[model samples]
Target: MKSILFSTTLIAFLALIPAGEAAAQLIPQPWVSVGSRNDETTFSIGARALNLGVEFGLGTEDSTGVDALAFVNLPLIDQVSPYVGLGLYSEDQGVAVSGGVQINPTDNLILGAGYHSIRGVNGQVGFRF
Candidate 1:
């Protein structure tokens, strides 16, 4: 069945992660974000492993969602760093295309604004190590 094939593929991919050349560059950090979408406020708590991050959201109207994002981190002349990402989302409201920009004013804090194709606009503030 398709499900079996998908599960097998996923397991194989996970098994190979530890052998990746960039494994040493993976930094895991706890992350939190608050945003607005579909005229409702949404909050997410998750972890970032290198350029990839996954989060679960608690939104208004009791809607909940999950997101998997991959981002590019760009460092500027000042201490600021900006990142852009594209990803997939699964939400109680509906599925969506998710992408966002996060800016780090300092090494620990982040200010972000973003959008989801189906969920609408978003903003966030979080701290990470």
Candidate 2:
């Protein structure tokens, strides 16, 4: 059956990932952002592992939906970086694209501003805890 085949593929894919190595990434980056989606307010929480990040977004009550995003973080300089990503959203919002810059003035601090096709502009602050 189609479902069985998909399940097998999913399991196989997960099996190939180096779970232990990924969990052992040098820096544990946890961040949060507040933005807008189609003029409605949205908030997101995400984490970074080396050059990758994933975010989960929650929309306004009127909008009533969630978004999941995956990003590739590229370092541009010693204390700054730019990122690009794509994601899916609920409530028939469809796919969204995003790009942003992050500023790390100190090892324990992160500040960011970004634009999301579906989530609008957002500002973020993160730090080691």
Candidate 3:
């Protein structure tokens, strides 16, 4: 009797959750960026959940050696929105500021070009879930 009751409760609880919400966890929303920082090549890879994003960056030889940015902007589906971020520049041992606008051409594709206080101009491509 206890086994049957437990099984029934588990089934009911699972059914109460939305399918889309559950499936979103299985889908990947990733982003990549490349550009110049301090006149050297920079690259970053990242992922997003809702409006929040976190990316790790390699700032090349001229700038800081490595950095990371954590930001919140309009969600990935939005056509255009300004993004403001705070980051760390490891070699300089200082805080980094990132700001730009991200452009979304489709539900799954994002394109961005912008300037930064330390990282300079960059173009980003991202995927939405």
Q: lDDT tens digits, residues 37-99, model 2?
A: 666787888777655678777654433333443444343465677788877777776777788
Candidate order, lDDT descending: 2, 3, 1
Local lDDT at 88 for model 2: 74
- Please give the CA lDDT of all the candidate structures: 0.63, 0.72, 0.66
Which residue pairs in model 2 clash with each other? Answer: 36-119
| lDDT at 123, model 3 | 88
* Residue-level error in angstroms, candidate 3, position 122: 0.3
Best by TM-score: 2
**lDDT of prediction 3:** 0.66
lDDT of candidate 1 over 60-109, digit per residue (tens): 56766777777664534433334444434444556646776776677677
TM-score pick, better of 1 and 2: 2
List runs of model 2 lying over 4 Å from the truth. Answer: 1-25, 37-39, 60-76
lDDT of 2: 0.72
Q: What are the per-residue Cα lDDT tens digits for candidate 3 across 13-52?
A: 5576468744653465677888886568878776654445
